[model samples]
Target: MSMDELKRRLGQVSDLNAAAGLLSWDQETQMPPEGARVRGLQMATLEGLTHELFTAPRTAELLDAAGTPAGETDAAVVRVARRDFEKATRLPTEFVEEAARARNEAHHAWLDARERSHFATFAPHLGKMIDLARRRADLLGYEDHPYNALLDEYEPGMRSGQVRAVFADLRDRTLPLLRRVTAAGNAADYGVLTRPFSPEAQKAFAWRVAGEAFGLGPAFSRQDESAHPFQTNFSREDVRITTRVEAYWPACLFGTWHETGHAMYERGVAPRWERTPVSAGASLGVHESQSRLFENLLARSRPFWERYLPALAKVAPEVTAGLDADTIYRAVNRVQPSLIRVEADEVTYNFHVMLRFELELALLEGTLRVAELPEAWNAKMHDYLGLTPPDDARGVLQDIHWSAGLIGYFPTYTLGNLLSVQLLEAARRDPEIAAGIERAEYAPLLAWLAEQVHSHGRSLTPAELTERATGRALSADPYVAYLHAKYEDIYGLKAEG
Candidate 1:
């Protein structure tokens, strides 16, 4: 009876989260512009109520009654719920509501600011966001750095020191290979990707790949258009992915595949786990691994294009009139320094992530002022990618993370990149998965990941999941080795050092 009651209470929390998720989805997709004012209040009210109910003294009594669970699933439920309850109890209900309001207002302001290519319009909100982040960190308490508190929210048990060490090692090892790739003058004929295609045609081709090819069907999950591409779900059975359509086709095509990866992870979680603490991905980094694995490893591989290029031709044959598999593969894999993180090539992508990670650290540490963010951002772009943003849209305002109060989220993208390679190498070891990749049949591969990674949900930590899935601790060696091999094959330059 006690376990049953605990489950019932946890189910209520999930339902509330789903309610908030629906509000956020509508605000992003369908809500009118002026509705922002009321929407923020609605979000805050839900958030406050959610926090209060979860942290009530009654929950403590229930946990004491449940005691130590014996079974694996029951143990996980008690353990995670207890951890969350302790943390939520530390944060006041007013803080929760205020943070939600700040996030909502700032999100709308960010849309307008990015469109206008203005940072000043969003600076005050970012300041408030940073202040709230600091306040939350203080409320939560931290040992070494306040940033650790925020980062731990996304990557459990991870610290800024650990992230710094990992990124430093990655940058030291990969930058040389990146320079070699850059110095090689064999530029891909990337113009093929930027050619004009009608929006309707682009949508049809992209969703076909997402739905028919990638296994995200209309019944369980669907895709939509948003200013910035993202995937969110109220439940495993009701996943939604969104992307922006561009005149250039790669943005929509690759973006759809990227988000489909996230949707698949959410959809693949064991259905019996829904409305529970363990219903989501193990961690944001692990979640990112799925997205990156699908986006880069699978979608951009030679076999994938070989299989899907024909399908694409049937949908938008004008763009592929004279194109072949090798050309499309090379075009998609071209290594170049790009101003946008989303468009960055595989080799240079982490540099974009690293830049944001460092800037976020500085912001949280109070070493950098919010007003000086654009200048700091431009400097990092020049240092890391050898380019400078000409405007705020291309610079500090490019990402919605800060405006939406996602302070510690940027580092997970790089962690996701590293884990993506580690997980793929592990998955490919299975002969069925290996052959499935060779033949462009992803069912075996997807099934492998569903069994290995997605099915557990939050039952394990990122490290535990990485070791279980890959048979080793998370290391940059596989990722670096993968880069060296793939880029050397493409550019005819060995970056061995």
Candidate 2:
């Protein structure tokens, strides 16, 4: 088949995936409680169809027939399609459909289970998902570890052992920094965020800042609310993010900032690449870097609040009641060991991912059972962050990942945190981006990412993209140094040279 025919075929597969993606977007946003029953089958049908279309014998024939591509973009299309075909062909359509149905059913079960704080209701579903993941890993055939098979799905070319080493280094460095901050007590007045604020005002101000401050304008991108905060896109033209609003102000403010990072990156992908395999961000880790960068490196910084606080004050006067940028910055950056991963402070956040990664490995290995998850989870929480859960809602049932069959996805969160700082360091080296950031104009930074990371999409591997953008491979040093300097200043603690 010709290159055009290859792209046309890939585009058709992309369209099928897009249709399912729209259903997923609604599944999280607008679908009613009863809709989940049918939604599972609906999504499963789409999954199976896309799998069949992508993995057909003709795809491999086409991939081989395409001679050396003329450009990076075309080469990427052929290359990515081949990689996907290898994985897709490993599983039968029946397996794909079953996994999808299981994921959909488990997702709904998770929601209901979380609301009731009952793990028993969700345990059987989680077991089914875990069993499915094991079967998938077996089908995919990993050499070192079964988890690596699943991990590669989200972060291609990344291995579980590499993640383990990185996490160990990160945990060692973070613990000392967290200790100093904890020892110093609360440096920023926690009262600023802990106090009640209007949910409406919070949403409006956050949404405005997301569009204006971060450059994720609503022309092609939009924001809404969901049970959990996430960003999704059907194509570059239509990107969506959902953030939960609650009594705690940061959930709306930072959640919007985080998802805006994702939406902006999605919206920024090169238009010519649409409906191709390379259309989306490089990987979930790379995608998470954008969200982490926007959430912590940009919006969470003092420079951002310096300009936006008054705007927030305009909408919710309570936020700025005698508070200045520095005070608010310190408060939002406070080191608190929390039960919820999403609500975790920066210093302790990766520990949450580590806990989940370890738990996932165990669950996948049959060393841990779904029934024993809460106890194991509480123990890890105590071991890692010095906190215990009062209920399963804040414990095992807190995150929607496991129930949705996202077993190998947790480690990407930490990878993103590390890469976010790495990307920020690289961008700030550009005088234009640095100036834009200080002035609360994000276009330069966004444009820099568009040119360097976003535009390439999945054309480049995550490691290659990180190296090209940052001039170095992924490292925890930059992220660790970043947290130390920022927190030491906030808490008035001295750091070891």
Candidate 3:
């Protein structure tokens, strides 16, 4: 097939993928419980069709012909599309459809189980998903570990061992910092954060702040509430985000900012690249970086509160009436071991990911059983944080990732923590930009991000993108240093305790 033919085919595949996404979104946000079976079939059919289209004999022949030296007309286009084709061609259509159906069903089961606080309800479904996932890894084939096949789905050319190497370094450096902060104790009273704040007001506040404060333009975006806070995009012009609100907690606020960070990255992609291979963030890790960067580095900062707390006070005057900026900032950043992974403090948040990474690795490798997950999760939580959940809702069923067949996705959250700090180090060099945050003007920082990172779309690899934007390789130093500096100042503890 010719280069032009390949491009047209690629556009057709993109349309199918977009349709599948919109259907899944509806299932999650608006579909009735009775619609689950139809939604599953719809999702499976779409995925199978997508897999068939990309893996057809003609598509493979075209990709190979165009990618070869004699037939290569445009090296970049051939390179990107061929890479995708090769990866897609390796998996079976049956596996793809099965995985999609299992994922959609598991997600819905997870919602029900979480609401009922019954891990038993979701256990068998998760077991089937994990089994399907392992089959997927085997079909994809790996030289070292099956988990590598899963990891490549999110971060190409990356292996499980490589992820473990980075995670080990992070754990070593982060644990002591956690100990010191624990010893120093939480320096602020976060009890006020749980006081009554209306859900309607919270939604309104989150939406306004997403645009006005976080640089997420309302022109291309809309915010809605869901069982989980997430951002999904059809294109730069149509990005959608969702968050859940709690009348007695601060989770929705930060979760909104986190999803908005994701929305920003999606919305910031170059318009010229829409519906192509180069249309989004470089990888899941890089995507997570944008979300973490906004959620922690900018939105949770003392300067941010100084500018926005009064506005919050106006909305929930009873909750924030006499609360000053320092008090609120400290409250938002309070470090404590928590049952919910999504609501954890910055210091302990990655620990949650670390546990999931280890557990998923075991589950995929066949060393862990589905029926034993509840016990294993309890033990890990006890070992890691010295606290245990009374039920599965706050334990094994806490995250939406695994039920979505996202086995290797947990590590990216921690990787995002590392990426965000390095990126923030780069962004904070401008004095004017730092002052802009204090004044609640985020355009300078947002523009810097757009210029430095977001404009590239998915044209670069994660390593190349990080190096170009931050002038450093992906590493543990920036994150460790950032945590040391910030927590030491806030909690008055030495790095070594």
Candidate 2 residue lDDT tens string, 352-458: 99999999999988899888999999999999888899999999999988887998999999999999999989999999889988887888988898899888888
lDDT of 1 by residue, 1-497 (tens): 88888889889999999999999988888999999999999999999988888898888988889898898888888888898898899899999999999999899889999999988998899999999999999999998999899998899988999899999999998898888888997556878887768888887788888876578989988777888889999999899999888876888889899999999999999876888888999889999999998899989999999999888888777778789988889988999898988888899999998999899889888999999999999999999999999999988888878888999988898898899999989988989889999878899889989999999988889999999999999888899899999999888885576
Candidate 2 differs from the real structure by a C-alpha RMSD in angstroms, to one decimal, of 1.1
lDDT of each model, Cα atoms only?
Answer: 0.89, 0.89, 0.84
TM-score of each: 0.98, 0.98, 0.96
Candidate 3 displacement at residue 468 in angstroms: 0.9
Cα misplacement distance, residue 356 of candidate 3 (Å)? 0.5
Candidate 3, pairs of clashing residues: none
Q: What is the C-alpha RMSD of each candidate to the true structure, in Å?
A: 1.1, 1.1, 2.1
- Number of clashing pairs, model 1? 0
Candidate 3 local lDDT, 136-170, one digit each (tens): 78877887888888888788777888888887887
The TM-score that candidate 1 achieves is: 0.98
